[model samples]
Target chain A: MSTAYGVAAVVLVVLASALIGGFGIRLSRTTSDFYVASRTVSPLWNASAIGGEYLSAASFLGVAGLILVHGADMLWLPVGWTGGYLVLLVLVSAPLRRSGAYTLPDFAEARLESMLVRRTAGVLVVLIGWLYLMPQFQSAGLVLRAITGAPEGVGGLLVAAVVAVNVLSGGMRSITFVQAFQYWLKLTALAVPLVFLLLAWRADGTPGPGAGAATWALPLAGGREYGLYSTYSLILATFLGTMGLPHVLVRFYTNPDGRAARRTTLAVLALLGAFYLMPAVYGTLGRIYLPGLRGGDMVVLTLPARLVGGVAGDLLTALVTAGAFAAFLSTSSGLTVSVAGVIGQDILRGGVRSFQAAAVVAVVVPLGLASLTRPLPVADVVGLAFAVAASSFCPLLVLGIWWRRLTSAGATAGLLTGGGLACGAVLLTLVGGPHTGLAGALLAQPAAWSVPVAFVVMIVVSLLTPGRIPPGVARIMVRLHTPETLDLDRGDWRPRSS
Target chain B: MATRHDDASVYERIEADDRFRELRRRFRSWVFPMTAAFLAWYLLYVALSGWARDLMAVKVLGNVNVALVLGLLQFVSTFLIAWAYSRYAARRLDPLAGEIRAEAEHEAERERA
Candidate 1:
């Protein structure tokens, strides 16, 4: 691809993001606006924003890359990513919105009424957010270097600066608009070139995936060790992980009520279902057209030029580059806001200034880590984050909402056992080098063990610590499960008509 | 009915209310079954791909196989579950929850008076 086109595309995306971000704040006011956009976003807009933020570089680049390398088995990555929202829709969405909490820690405090539980949750939220953000920053470098041939660090630095600026200036209110727009932009950017790419394929009588050794089409093919267990672990993490992401949960808080949250999630299911379909196309086509590519991440970037070949091809590649950057920017901004929100609430005094300071800290810490860490496959790193979230927050959200017997001690114990173990596994996987046997698989994908352990520990501790149940459990349960139309003085209420 | 500031009693009243019970029952009726079924479906897909590669690899159409169709069905099931859940909530759950809310509000107002 031409350097000029690539650079131009990156510049335009950044400028557009900045413009929307800078102006988005003028339309925002009040603490509610900063936190949850005053809980006034409609289902369509909220859904779009969710789709925008949720579909990170993993969805944009990593899925195709994985599919190119591993073939059919990797399809589950996108399946789980989108289906994770379905889990969110049915289980967590409405009640979480009804809780009227600004962040995950607030929800914990509101539900458990224990400062210890709340503080524990606050820590996990920051850890998960930072873990998730590191990959986005690293992938931005990959995209930038792939396109413009710039130094790898340039992309991460550029994204960190842009995201910090966006969050510090306007927080969630500014981001909602920017993310919603980026969703459509990303869809068009990937989808438009796709039509041409398909046309090119058809014109050339599109070959099959390189006369595949039949196993390529098989789901758990290529003699993957512990393939069955690994698949189950991946399923466990992603299926349960969606509800636990700090950024995803905060979006539900932007809905006016539980009903709207349900609606927004439904819309998200549709939008994401559509958006996810396009990547498999790129992945499959890359296999057929650009076989034996060195880096699967670059498959999406290079496929268009390889298949189409001309100024037109260069333009399409540039479009995909722009889309990839949007993926990084929108996802990084959302994570930064959620992480910064937690930091601002727990670490610093609450307010816009604290949030601004936290935003810098949020992005910069991850940016520094991205620089220091050896680059893992972007999708693998993201999966590790999901595993940690599933083992930790999934248990918390599920048990917290439904079970009144849950005590603060139980919740804290569960988070530590679940989240702590998952994080330990992630660290081992990152630093210990790849292992070759059962030990390797367990460490590589810990959700299968860790999530169950968390749940069991929580239940057992809650049973033993029965006396420690928060006295406010009934009222909190009523508030969370009850319809908002109820007129009871749900104490500490805020007017929603802002 | 309970005093305005007595949140525990108010919650107790709401908890005891027939409509609130009905709301909880109806919401749980769908959500629990739907969640269980989706998880079952997803796990089955994972299990099949994990343990039964031949079945997954069996060709159904030209260049398309069972795995591909099942993969697509994952998305289909997600959309279906989401759409079905939304409709169910709108039709059955919301109205019941609303009724309970209205009663709670009425009780609060009477207590205030």
Candidate 2:
């Protein structure tokens, strides 16, 4: 509603982030601190940071908007997102931390002993990072346009600038503090407004989501074609996809040990479960209150002003606006750090200077992509990123950790096939536009098929090329599975050439 | 090449140890089954939401339907499984793994010194 409040919120968030990041930089002096915070972050702080980075523009703004439009079925997106972390907790988290890798590529090289596998993983990390980051930038533009009426490009530019400055100044250590702070800020931003909105609804006699819109309240009752298939595909993508996200996986490396990693993941589950509760509140309320509203993504921003009109409403709107900005910054910062880490270690010299340079490149590429590409619904693009991740990295991480017979050729083949197919499907959906019928539904949500194919190909190829298995497989397995508290001589798996 | 061969054999010896096998078995037994159980439970919820719309729409509480309840239960089960796993790891998985790790470390030190 008011540009002054919105602008002030944005400025304050930026200043706070920069301040926290600068403080973190002062505390961090070594290369290890810059890369993984010297592996000293505790469970609660790391969990909060994970929640902060994980709850992107898609979760903050898009989930509510989708629910506003699609109703009951849209709940699955958030459910699948939370459940994805459960999958991570059970399968990936502790072992990944125990792998002692700075980035996914490090894990790949260390596990498979193949430069090719490492390079392929490096490429996928950048690809997924860009795919995930584009939405945060685009949504930054959208929210800024909604709040202050700035040109779309300016908002993206502002976010890119802030994220770059933060990442360059402090690296992972500072980014962790910045993100952990944002998680609490975002929770309050949504939760406070929700209290008043619920009270307002109560004062107005608690109406349902309008009379006789039966399908709106019911999950698959919506007349969209191939609803069952799309739902299942979305479920598969998110449940498996989370472990593969570049930023998310990198957070595990910050945990002090495997035990802390598991504990941090449990905390993340609780934090996310609490935060996800508010979005549906905003979405369902939007239906009952602002029945005629279009651009569903704007519902969270617009609902406060519409339902609670006045200075208080403006203030609430500003709070949520600031939270939205935080979402963009935290997620973008985490993504940039992970992408930069991979690029620094793999492409340039492995040092803080290279990471700083890579951070700029990481943010710049996504900001450029954001400007060039037409914006999709923020959540859908994010889901596509997850699908790509599920197809590629999920198989790699799961098999690489547990399956000793996995060979370099197998991993290389699986990464290309799965990542390539998922990326192709995503590109078709984005550029070729929407299609009808079975092919369209399959293209729209590719994870249901892509994930299985990736796993099978990985297994078969590994079986065929059994001789290519790394000779140190037993040692690597012992390192990955054992408790870090153990006094065993796990090989020093530092970032290469650092 | 000789150093690499020795390292591999040492790790292979540890891997073949009965205690190491027990540790591996304990971990796989807990995680694999739990992973499968939770995934199956979650998929069942998704399936019901998709195909059993009429059933999901059945109101358990005022304006709260089977769909909403099932979705909330997914959250509950996630937290529950997380808590259960942490407990299980603490009691069963961690101690044995620690013992194995200590034994392996001792063996390696003896070999070196």
Return the TM-score for candidate 2, rounded to 2 decimals. 0.97
Candidate 1 per-residue C-alpha lDDT over A1-498 given as tens digits, one digit per residue, 9 for 90 to 100 = 798999999999999998988877787666566777877889899999999999999999898888887788888888898889888887877777677676778888888888898899989999999899998999999889888788999999999999888887787888998999899989998999999999999999867776763677777776356777888898889989988899998898788777788888888888988988888889889888777887688888898899888999999999999999999999999999889888887888877777778889999888988998887778888999999999989999999999999999999999999999999999888776456688888988899999999999999999999999999787888888877556555544332222
TM-score of 1: 0.96
A425-464: candidate 2 lDDT, tens digit per residue: 9999877756678998898899999999999999999999
Question: Which structure among the candidates has the greatest lDDT?
Answer: 2
RMSD of every prediction: 2.2, 1.9
Q: What is the DockQ score, from 0 to 1, of model 2?
A: 0.55
> What's the CA error at residue A243 for candidate 2, in Å?
0.7
Scored against the true structure, residue A311 in model 1 reaches a CA lDDT of 97
lDDT by residue (tens digit), candidate 1, B1-113: 34546867777777787887788888898999888988999889877887787888888986789989999999988899888988988899878777776776777778778
Clashes of 2: 0
Q: Identify the candidate with maximal DockQ.
A: 1
Model 2's CAPRI class?
medium
Task: List TM-score per model, in order.
Answer: 0.96, 0.97
